[model samples]
Target: MPRAYEEIADERQHGRDTHVRRPRARVVRDSGRHQWEKDRARRPPAVRAATGATERDTGLLPDDLVFSARYRTIEAPGELAEAFGVCEGTALLERSYRTRYAAETAPFSLVTSYLPHALAAANPDLLDVSREPWPGGTHHQLSTVGIEIDRVEERVSARPPTPQETRELELPAGTAVILVRKTSYDTRGRIVDVSDVVLPGDRTELFFTTRLERW
Candidate 1:
């Protein structure tokens, strides 16, 4: 009877078992097949360019990309750190200019770049020195008028748009804002300008052209 009871228990345990098997993963040996799969995976899903891709393309124009710039004076580095929530060391000078602009129109604003502009404004003496135009080829229009750029530092950040910015900028869903901190220096290597710009990635383009001489 003990043997019979053990046999019954075994039968009960195995009663619900079904005959099925999962397919094992196999490694393909053909180099061509493996390469083809890799290439297919790397290819972009759609033919159209992804968001923010057009900023690098030359065909797009600056006006086509909607943006805005707001200028302000930085009183204290600690105050700036508190207002922007950035590190205190990040704010360098005692006084600086801040300019903020948009990265895209339909989306939100992103702080794409930053530089100091007040150092130049502080000392009118160094404004006459001709500094190279930003991105090259273009003439130094500002310097010609007694405004020189010495050095520029940039900081970038991203966050969701405010309710007013969203309605005014006409932002879309799942969009991000960019903030750019720009600092400019004079010929004496003094921090002259500081500005902040915000941009939306979906509807904005940043064009940078550099002219290089033959090496």
Candidate 2:
């Protein structure tokens, strides 16, 4: 649910203030399939322009990606706990996102990222959604705290979205959704963050590049 609606529902359930405002959803659009492709070795000049590149580094120069993030802190869920290698009672900072293209109202994808409180405690800003779009993205943010992400593991799968997902992503009947679960690991092999991304099957694509060693 949108954060605003969730707040309103909570208030109503407790017979509290009924004047709660509903939060608006943010949409992000993709220019082409370029953003989905993995090409770190051949990054465009824009990426090199900054010591730390953000959404703008993806070749959307002049036009930046627009989005909103709803954040919360909660006990780590079972699956999240396993991914983080922590006990179930650990606290986690969750940032839920909806991104849209310039001037567009519908979202291109839905994303949620979870950060272990223990690891993220160094930077108070990471716990707050209001601080997001994080200038240089998570990499720069983590670097500030002496943690370097050396490996990123992305697992992709496709399946039918739930009814709620269907409504949120505005998918049509029989449409499948592409799910990408990305886990970031530090040099010490500690999981720093895990992000779940949902892409509209009709408008999303993925690409990979590999170089084989000659024997």
Candidate 3:
């Protein structure tokens, strides 16, 4: 059966809105670095375009920002305890960072990281938030204590942002957020660190590539 005219119009408007404003085009690829490579000269890929007359600015996050991180000790939550194979009340270092953009009202992604206190206690600097954006990111931090991250697994999910997330992210109504739970393991097959990251869906893209063994 032919679609109703009103429903067709609504669908068309939604398509146009995404194409013209929020393209979600950034290819969020992993370069195998715990931190992004400093490539200030790289321009973000272009947004989906219409004719030259209709092309508009891309919805990209700011390139400059104020960085802040808070660190504290807490008992491991049950799920984390199970994943780390530690006692239910094992102490863990909880670190959270809050970023304020130079040009935008909304903040960027939210991330919370957890590490076993026993492991990090070996390096006093790991407990200090002041040392962050810490020279080489997580993998480097772990190295200072003889822990080498051998592999990482990330699980991605999405759902509408919570009321608090909407306000903090300054998201427009009906927008969603992407959630990534990343687990890092050392050569011993022990889960060494875990991070939960929340990304705003309006401006982010997820990408991955795989190589195959020679047949």
Candidate 4:
């Protein structure tokens, strides 16, 4: 268990409800992040375009804005490997990131992405951490080796931020977070990538739209 959760568990042992805390910030709803309507899944190009547009719309450009990425590959945890339908010891490419507006001291969010080593090794670029923020994003990179993404799946849940997460997001005390696990599948139904995003609940809103066909 994460230390933060451990702390909460310890507190629970003493008899206390942790849900009474109020959030202290707000992040605009991410339509792209939460939407599944019309198969409007988020791709790499869209990510860059959205981020760039956001910076532009906010009156900041190359001179005043910057985006940074830090990543690496690590052995997949048992559960993570299971998510990829692989054995426990499989190696997976892991990329950790922190994106932020230059003027702000805190990052916009914390993201960690993973790709199975066997799949990514097909294209050397995928294994090279320095290749990011790959001009087109993961979708384009995968396309280099003839992989076509057919769909995306996202599972969302909420929990109190861990000590590490709280410090990284610069979240205030009593703030919980929204946890998003996004999975990408290829035309062959193979899980190509999985990304975990941690969004500050106080600063984030989720929206979904569903359309029903006319009978």
Q: Which candidate model has the greater TM-score, 1 or 3?
A: 3
Candidate 2: residue 200 Cα off by (Å): 0.7
lDDT of 4 by residue, 1-215 (tens): 33453555466678776664332223453435322221222344555444442342233454444567776668889889889998887888888876565434466678888988878889887887777656446666677788877788889999999999898888878989899898988899999899998988766667666577999
What is the C-alpha lDDT profile of model 1 across 44-87, one tens digit per residue? 53421222222322233333344333333343467555543455
lDDT string, candidate 2, 119-213, tens digits: 67788877777876555466666766887777788888999989888888777678899998989888999999899989878656565665579
| Cα lDDT of model 3 by residue, 88-192, tens digit | 999999998766444334556778999999999999999888886564467667877998777788999999999988888777778899998988899899999
TM-score of each: 0.37, 0.72, 0.73, 0.74
RMSD of each: 22.4, 10.3, 11.1, 10.5
Candidate 2 lDDT trough over 10 residues, lowest sum: 32-41
Q: Judged by TM-score relative to the true structure, which candidate is superior, 2 or 4?
A: 4
| Candidate 4: segments with Cα more than 4 A from true spot | 1-64
Task: Give candidate 3's whole-model lDDT.
Answer: 0.67
Overall lDDT per candidate, in order of appearance: 0.39, 0.67, 0.67, 0.68
TM-score of 1: 0.37
lDDT of 2: 0.67
Worst 10 residues of 1 by lDDT: 22-31
Against the true structure, whose lDDT is highest?
Answer: 4
Return the number of clashes found in candidate 4: 3
lDDT of 3 at 10: 62
